[model samples]
Target chain A: MKKLINSADTILEESLDGFAAAHADILLLGAERKFVRRRTLKPGKVALISGGGSGHEPLHAGFVGLGMLDAACPGQVFTSPTPDQMIEAAEAVDTGAGVLFIVKNYEGDVMNFTMAAEMAGREVASVVTNDDVAVEKSTYTTGRRGVAGTLIVEKMVGAAAETGLPLAALTALGEEVNRRTRSMGVALLPCTVPAAGRPNFALADNEMEMGVGIHGEPGRRRVPLASADAIAAELLDAILKDLAPGKGSEVLLLVNGFGATPLIELYLMVNAAKRILDSAGVAVVRFLTGSYVTSLDMAGVSITVSVLDSKSTKLWDAPVQTAALRWGV
Target chain B: MKKLINSADTILEESLDGFAAAHADILLLGAERKFVRRRTLKPGKVALISGGGSGHEPLHAGFVGLGMLDAACPGQVFTSPTPDQMIEAAEAVDTGAGVLFIVKNYEGDVMNFTMAAEMAGREVASVVTNDDVAVEKSTYTTGRRGVAGTLIVEKMVGAAAETGLPLAALTALGEEVNRRTRSMGVALLPCTVPAAGRPNFALADNEMEMGVGIHGEPGRRRVPLASADAIAAELLDAILKDLAPGKGSEVLLLVNGFGATPLIELYLMVNAAKRILDSAGVAVVRFLTGSYVTSLDMAGVSITVSVLDSKSTKLWDAPVQTAALRWGV
Candidate 1:
């Protein structure tokens, strides 16, 4: 793989080191190198933590700061972080209010975070997000594979946590956010894992992997490449079908790129998505378009629609200051 | 080319439509669809206007909002925007303080912006940025090519403009920013224009282009791909050679991805850059890493180092909320 990395074995360590240095003002290395926590913790505020495999950057680690994740435990690429990493992160960031771990719905992630919560003697709560409607079963997951909707959950839950919600309330809020969100993704190119040194899957130039998972897991089916509008219609239809928003209902839209897609294309996809939503009589109250969640150099786009109530809208619009997403701070 | 574009002919217009729709709160389509301006302008604030060929997503357009450009005129893919578009944008954004046009140092850009300023029929000042130290001449220019350093100019001058700097002062400030900055880039892969449906340049599987321009122009030389550390060292060394930063001098370092490179690689590069700068006895007072400026889908990075005094540092730290870059607000 033509990647700008050191030795493949050192990729994780070096990347973490760089991430720590780049965001030193808001984050610091946790007790263990595999985790990162906020530089300062509020004594009575609920601490929010989320993590998964390392490839989906700006997800867990990049969100570590004020108004977002208090701590993040990143695993090696596509591998789950050990329970010890999660425990250390939780212990380090848990204020008297308690700690909440937002785990994506993957078997390894769910199990390890559960173990970490059990190991942590302090008050700990966990919320598992399974908002990806693309697949009910995948290589690394059972039921639904959590995908881009995790970003929405993190933002809303982080905002709610910042309001001094207790652990139980915060966990319930996270689960509610997950319940109201749905996501679907399409991949034009499979990403190469540095360790593997090749693409995880191969496809002809004219074909695309629809409903592909973040780690190149199986999706609905392979299909011939279509126009951006068609792809947008398909992904948006899938998400709205799963969401089933009532007419004139307001929704927050997220059109995310899978790493390699450029902003222009994301904007194009956003246009298509907006048109589709308009035709469906849904009002896009707020929209975010970019690579908020990403695969490792994968060329694809994902559409996520979250049905929003007034409280959810307030939480979503709340100020956030993080490495990747920031505004109104 | 494998891109998520519907058609080359409509890509620019559609992308602009999406941008306008997505950022409606902060931006509005100008008299002509070719230009976009901030939704509201501060009365008597010196307006900053910038534009260039399309494909450099989030450069000029995404920088428009709050304490940045008042208007942006996007051209066709890899083509200079017309004088008429600039005239319309300038007329719409100019309030009595006059407008400062920030043009990149390309023949077409310079000539067109010049015509637009003359036709503006208002007090107008223009500054052309040519901070790329890669080559004195390239496929599109007689002098140095303007690359990522334009971002530094816009941000600092934008802050200065918000402080009510007059047309002449903002123009001079932009010129000063261009003077203090130097940049060099390396491309691992060439980008393809959607219309062309092929790569702009060719490279062997194991080779990379050093000192490459944003538009895939000829660089200093091509070399076999090296490790991330080696690549970082090479790029930083060239920029420092051109800059010749004094010992203990404070600098703002920008490690910009050329669109397709992921954050992980850019962070890896930041680590390498910081180490090199620390060893060189130069203090990095501030730094920004991400794809602030980009070629459509090129896999590459550019390093910009700008010597900063106290005033420049304050300007850089000032709050500016735009779609692409935001902090300290």
Candidate 2:
């Protein structure tokens, strides 16, 4: 693969180094580079920590800042971080208020974070996210895999946590946010893991994998490449079917890119998705469109809808100072 | 080509509709969808207006909001907007303080913006950006073609305009920022325009175009695919040579992706660029990395270094609430 990296073996560390350097004001690298924690900690506030494989950038680490993740443990590309890494990150970022581990519903990640919480000498809780309605079981996950909606979970729960909520309360809020969110993705092109030096999968020029996972795992089905409106209809139909929002329910719509999709296309998808939602009688109170959660260089898009209550809507609008998602203050 | 678009004819309008819907709080769509202007304009503040091809998103349009461009016109993909679009944008956004046109140095863009300025009834000034050091003359430009450094010009000058600088002063500031900035890009893969339905250019699996333009134009030369470090050195060598900042000069280093390049690769490139800057005794006082300026879905990156003086540095740090670039606001 003609990737812009020195070597697959050193890609993660080198990228982490660069990330730490570039966002030094917002984050600090933990010892041995096991994790990245916010540079300034809010004492007595619940510390929210999250992490997963490294390929999905601006996910866990980019969310670390004033109103989001307190710390993030990044593993090698598509590999889970060790329990020791999570424990150390908890030790560093957890104030006396305790810690909340926001784990995606992946086998390796869940197991490791569970182990970390068990071994860590603190009041710790975990919220496992499984918002991807794309699959009940996948190559790396059981049940629905956590996808772009994980960002919504972190954002909403992170805002609530910043209000000095207890760990238990924050965990509940995170779980609630995840429950209200659903996501589905489609892949137009496969991504290459530098280590593998080949695409994770192959597709004919006129084909697309619908409901694909963030790690390039097989989705519901491969279909002929379709126009944006048709693709949006399929993805949003599945999401709305699972969500089953009331006729006038207000929601937040997120159009996330799977790395290679440009903003132009993502916005176009957003327009198509909005049209579909309008016809479905769902009111989109907020909209987010970008490549916040990405899979290497996969060319695709994911639609995330989170049913918003007054509290959740307020939290979603709350000021966030993360590297990837920022607004008011 | 596999793309998330309905049709080439509808792509621009659909994306614009989505953008206008998503960022309604920050901007408003002009009549006939000619341009996007700030939702809340400062009555007496100098207005900044910019426009170019639509493919390089978040450039002209995304930069419209508080502390940036007051209005932005988006042309068809890789094509310049008509002079009528620019004139209407100037009419819509110009306040008593006048309007400043930040035009990229392309044949069509420069010519159209010039015609707009001449026809504009209100006071008007222009700052033409030509920061690319790749070629003296290329397919669409005379002198060095403007590239990613145009973003830096808009940012720094946008901040100055927000402070109520006169159109003339803002124009001078923009030109000064342009003079201090230099950029170079490299493309690993060519992107396809929806209308073309084929890659803009071709390269062997082991080939890359160094010093490439944002539109996938031929660059300095085609070379064998090389490691990030080697590529970063060659790009920085040309940029630093052209800029020739004094030792210990502080600079804002921007590592911009050409759409399809992942954040991991971009940050790794930032690390590589930083190391070179350190060796050259230039301190990077600021860092902005992302796919701010992009070709459709080209897999590559561009590095921009803007030598910062005290005034320009302060302006760069000033609050900017644009959709794409936001910090300290």
Candidate 3:
């Protein structure tokens, strides 16, 4: 695969070690390296924890800090973490206010987190995210896969949780945010898991996989490569059809890179998406363009649309301090 | 060739439009779209202006905002910006405090920026960055090629300029920062320019280009692909040799990705680089890791080490609010 790693077996541990060292100011490695938690806990505040496979970096771990995730459990590449990791994370970061688990709709992840919550001795609740409108069922997920829209859920709910919301309230907020969001991705090139030593899938030079999942799962269809405008139109059409925000509704538009897409192309896609939204009479109240939630080295882009209410908009603008997303801190 | 762009002809303008729309709060597009300037200008703060080829996505434009460049002019991909762009940028951003041009050491960039300063009709100074220690002279540069270390220069000098330093002092500070910084890059795959529609260069599947330039310029040599630790050691060896920072010296270590590399690999590189630094008795006081300075969609990385003194360290820690780098704003 020609990846920049020492050995496939050590990728997770070495990457975790590097992440912990680089962000030591804001993150702490939990016992057994099962999870990453905030260095300082806000007493009496609801603790928000999320995790999934490790390939999608800056998703769970990079979101841990002041106004985002309280802790994150990372498993091996595209593999779910054990229940012990989640339990230990809850034990470490959950103050007396209780804990909220933001779990994506992967079968392995859902089962492990559910087990963790059941076994953990604390007041815990879970918000399962299935915001990807790409497919109703995928290889790893029973329902629509949780894609880039998970970031919006974490962000809005994290801000609310930082206001000392009760665990039940935070869980409700997270679920509501997830309901308001939809995402779809298109892959230009497949990514290789370090251990796999080969790309998950191959594509002809002029072909693309549309509505692809974060783990490189089969999407809605494969088709001829198209222009940026056409691609944006297709992804946005799917998301808007599912989201169904009325005319003049305000929304947050996120053009997320699937690892290998450069910022310039992402911004270009943002422009294309904004044009589509403007014609659709959807007001883009806020815009975020970057590679926040990424598959390892997949060359693609995911478009996320989240309908924003007054409260959600305010929370989106609230200060956040994390390794990946930071502003007004 | 499978980039998410409409057309090679429209890539620059469309991307600029999206960047302006996305970061409307922090940036403004100049007339004729020659430059991007800060939305809210500090009337008396020394203006920091930088520009170069357009493919380096976030280097010049993304760094424009609070505590950074006042304006950035983007040229066509892999081409130097015209002198008129720089002159217009200076005219738009320069207050009574004068402007400082931070030019990378490339034939066209240095020549054009020099011409702009002379014709700018305002108090002006320049800091030419040549931080790449890979070659004494290369294809586009007479001395060292400016690479990722330009970000460090902009950051440290940006903080000093925010403190109301005059153009001369900021120029001197920038020069000092440049002197203390050294960088080297390695490429696993060559990136394609959208216009070219083909990879810039080719490497055997098992080979890599070490000490490569940001623009795919020839480097030290091509060798069999090595493990991350061995690559990190080689890059650091060259940088530490050039920097000659004595034992116990504090440094800011930056592991920058070349566009297509993922965050996981970058952080793993951070870990590898840190181990080498630790063993060398050099303390990393600050760590900045990401795809800040990039070569279109190249899959590679560059390692930069900047020796830090008390003042420079504080300046590095100071607030910076840009699209790519943000903290403590």
Best by lDDT: 3
Q: Give the per-residue lDDT of model 2 (tens digit) for A150-236.
A: 989999888988887888888889888999999999999999999899999999989999989999999999999999999999999
lDDT of 3 by residue, B1-329 (tens): 89998889999999999999999989999998999999988999999999999988898999999998999999999999999999999999988899999999999999999999999999989999999999999999999999999999999999999999888889899999999999999999999999999999999999999999999999999999999999999999999999999999999999999999999999999999999999999999888988999999999999999999999999998999887788888
1 or 3: which has the higher DockQ?
3
The window of 10 residues in a row where model 1 chain A has the poorest summed lDDT is: A25-34
Instruction: For candidate 1, report its TM-score.
Output: 0.99
Higher-scoring candidate on lDDT, 1 or 3: 3
Q: Global lDDT of each model?
A: 0.89, 0.92, 0.93
Candidate of highest DockQ: 3
Steric overlap count per candidate: 1, 0, 0
> How well is each residue in A52-152 modelled by candidate 3, as lDDT tens digits?
88989889899999889999999999999999999999999988899899999999999999999999999889999999999999999898888888989
iRMSD for every model: 1.1, 0.8, 0.7
CA displacement after TM-score superposition, residue B219 of candidate 1 (Å): 0.7
Comparison by DockQ, 2 against 3, better one: 3
**After superposing candidate 3, which stretches have Cα over 4 Å from the reference?**
none
Chain B of candidate 2 versus the native chain B: what TM-score? 0.99
Instruction: List where candidate 1 sits over 4 angstroms from the true fold.
Output: none
Give me the displacement of residue A95 in model 1, in angstroms.
Answer: 1.1
